[model samples]
Target: MVQYNEWMKDVNDDAKLSSLSVPGTHNSAACHVALPSVQCQGASVTDQLNHGVRFLDIRCAKLFLASGDDANDLQVIHGKFPVKIPFPLKLAKVLDEVYAFLQSHGSETVIVSLKQEGQDTWDNDSDEFPKVIWENYVRPHQDQWYLGSGIPRLGDTRGKAVLFRRFGVKDEQLSQNLGIDAHWWTYNTTDDDRGEIRVQDFCELNDTNDVQKKSDYVKQLTSQAIQYNATNPADPKLFLNFCSGSNFFNPECWPEKIAQCMSDANIQDCFGKGCGIVVLDYSEKDDYKLVKELVDKNF
Candidate 1:
């Protein structure tokens, strides 16, 4: 398995994350620290308690692979900070593949971006995330993988999130699906009554617009995660679970408010600085994947 280790941290609220920082690692994608922008580059990290994660400049980023399956050779691409940086061509290709694969999975996840909580120019709307989502809105649907997780951070949580936008969206149909605003990707290709269904199929099967939908799904999933903890306060019960704000997908953290209350009683990763904090139920994505499979097969 490709285990990702922390590289380094400098905790800067100003740096725009450029090339000089990463002189060694082949940069493919660089994420802006939604909270505390660190100044360190690629430093091998494993300890969960390391201040590196809390370095909070960027959420998660990785260098693209070498010239193999994923290669583009692009000069530089825009980052979450709207700053252009060098990315190995091969790495960009890998990101594109990951994006496609995620789209195909159709699972939802609410990303607590570690980037600075400020507006981004690339996004024209009121805020960066909403703006980027509005134009690139990929409305979440039933079968998509993104719908899997979405929730808000409790207590003194940090990090901001942008619901990644989707393309090839329809107006009314999408509106009905998400119970949110509807905006298509410009023009429709066909005019058949079943066009919406066909379009959905295309998006799901080809994974072309998978990133948009998956990103949206995650936003919604995380935003509403507190519901899982919706147990009666009078009869409060606590379950030994782990949470680092990412516990929205944890099984015990379902139903929103109930789960939040449950998490409040247990341990927390201390805003991700430490790791022994139990939120609701501590598990990995596979936990939900199994649940999703069971639900698909049974109910």
Candidate 2:
């Protein structure tokens, strides 16, 4: 039997990050006291990591300080709302949790997908979001991150947080070393192939009737990842299949409801195979069944 906490220890060091089946959570740190629409996860980040989830979908909103204060910070958010109610969750704190987990479990590596969420009032030239992240969050702890632009081997990333940057860069030099360039990812897409990374993030469900369509997209991407990895094991593109969606206006199509619908869609057929990163909402439901099934594929 594979242990949830240290499951990566069983995987071979030569395995590429893009080829392995990784379990991930969408809005991973949004498990606090927030509205149902904003809260996408049921378990805390620490719990997710301990339960064999190697990928984290973290959305950070840049909170600029006073006029001249250089000590700006990034707060975790979902869409335009803060994940936590009154007191917001900070990205630095989340990174600390990841680092602590890696220190204890030296064989495991966590892929953190960082996206700039919420409104952007700051000027792009004066305050570029990627540059802010690079200076404020990443530069301070550069050693703890895998900032390479290409897919990394598991051996090279052990005990490190692999950065999957989802924000754009204005400076030409900053763009060169700012992690895997998922900056050109399309929104609410069923299939957006950007060479190094492919995405299936069809997040808009017009109604409950659209759940099946969403599930179909999930399965299709899963098959693509499995087939690609099986044939070209040495070089594989990272596939991020998001099994999360909502209608926004319809309460029935909320995240939890969509998650329940997805749970019943018999999506398990996509599991126990190399399907890249399976990002889910409410991943803790059914005792982390989705995470466990995906993790088992490695062994």
Candidate 3:
């Protein structure tokens, strides 16, 4: 029951820990152990003076350099949603890890909160929209660029990323001191400059002629590279599933198509693309089921 709220309390915490990551602690030749870290909220803090440290942030982390005015300030870290601990020990360990982690990353503020209802908070990534655009638009550009011009395709590096999680929260009046929003968690790929093709985009009313044209173009491009093909990827009767939507979610709508495509392409990690895939299951103190459904539906 150490009240780490007292800054001094953290002094005697881990002696060998204090100089951690410093020249005294981290030697290039030093043999670091393989133990995992204890994450406070989502940040990994030091436990027993650091043998290991890392946590799964939103798979597609919103990585932008810190801005001015706040430039001197640490990158403020806050949950876009919420997370909670059923056990005190678990929470305490995470706190310990977060403390150590702050120094490692220049993050200024780290907020822990409870999950909320009716908000979009998941990243269901798939390849339909961009596939449509790429097959039709980008491919043509590539061909023309190669044939008689000089232009660079920016690729998917535009930072159009995604993140998603399922969690719960309690319902209460705002002023009641309810510990609801204090621990919400989310990995933010919130917006995009790159035209990130979303799952919803695939549902848009595309012209039948355009779809056929693009489909035909795709067939021509991959025909020699891939001898086999699937035209009606999503024939109403089939259902497909995967552990992740990868960096996007449009694929969920036509799961069978993706599975078939992956098998054809011989991808090692079919759903593991973009940043990295991690499923974090944390909750708040409230109606678990209802909150989760609301969050899932809205997000």
Candidate 4:
């Protein structure tokens, strides 16, 4: 039996990372938040990794502490005050989990799509943000992180969190454009979508109660992903399709509900060959069935 955690170890290293079907979690650390719409995940980082989720969508903010010292650490945040994480210790805890997982599973690599949020007091200072990230997070643990921009080989990034920075850059040298915007779009941005690894964030639920309509949208996107990946088998590209949504007014379009739509057996069958990296919400529930299906497709 294949180990649930180290499934990526079986993937061929010669193949480009972009070509493989990786399961990602959007707002991966939002499990602790109390709000309805912003909470995208239900599992901790270690649990998600153990469940075969190779990609992680992390949103962070630089928070200033009250001790006259700014604790340059990254705090996970979704929206403004209400949806933000309560304390700074959470980031440390999460990183500890990531480090432990990678140390044990040297053959697997994780992708962290990092974006900045919340009120940044250092907006006036151009170099502070990147410096904070470098000094606090990336520099001390440089060996454990894959800091490059372009898609990397699986072997090179093994046992590391390949940083995909989505935050603003003051120091270009800090990330080397590795943290480029993920090119997230709605349902109609199909024309401009062209890349070796394409991503679509079509989680807009106009009508919160319309479950059937949301399901149809998810099905349509998955079908398109199948066709997109099939176009070039020899040199396949990634299709990051998001199965997450939010509606402040109606809890029906919450992250869990959106994930349920993607959980259908018919939808899972669409990725029999592969579905690139399917980012989901509320992935900790349902025994991580959706993520397991994606990982199984890799082998």
- Model 1 Cα lDDT, one tens digit per residue, 16-85: 1110011011111222222122111222211211211211112221223424212212212223222223
Q: Compared with the true structure, what per-residue lDDT tens digits does model 4 show for residues 1-299? A: 56779887777777667667778898887877566677787778889998889888877665546422355556676755323445443455567778899999999988887666677666534756666666777778888888776677788889998887655565556547344335343443322255655655655576655545545555565666666656766665656666676666777777777677657534566664466677788887679887887777767
Q: What value of lDDT does candidate 2 attain over all alpha carbons?
A: 0.88
Q: Against the true structure, whose lDDT is highest?
A: 2
* TM-scores, all models, native as reference: 0.23, 0.96, 0.19, 0.85
RMSD of each: 19.8, 1.6, 22.8, 3.1
Model 4 poorest ten-residue lDDT run? 183-192
For candidate 3, lDDT tens digit of each residue in 10-54? 222221110111100101111122111112121222421122211
Error of 3 at 138 (Å): 45
lDDT of 2 by residue, 94-194 (tens): 99999999999999999999998787565677536777788888999899889998999999999999999887777778877778878787789999997
Model 4, residue pairs in steric clash = 165-179
Task: Give the true-structure RMSD of model 1.
Answer: 19.8
- What is the lDDT, from 0 to 100, of the residue 74 in candidate 1? 24
List residue ranges in candidate 2 displaced over 4 A.
64-71
lDDT of each: 0.22, 0.88, 0.21, 0.69
CA shift at 106, candidate 4, in angstroms? 0.6
Model 4 lDDT, residue 252, Cα: 72
lDDT of residue 189 for candidate 3? 23
* Total colliding residue pairs, candidate 3: 31
What ranking of all candidate models by lDDT puts the best one first? Answer: 2, 4, 1, 3
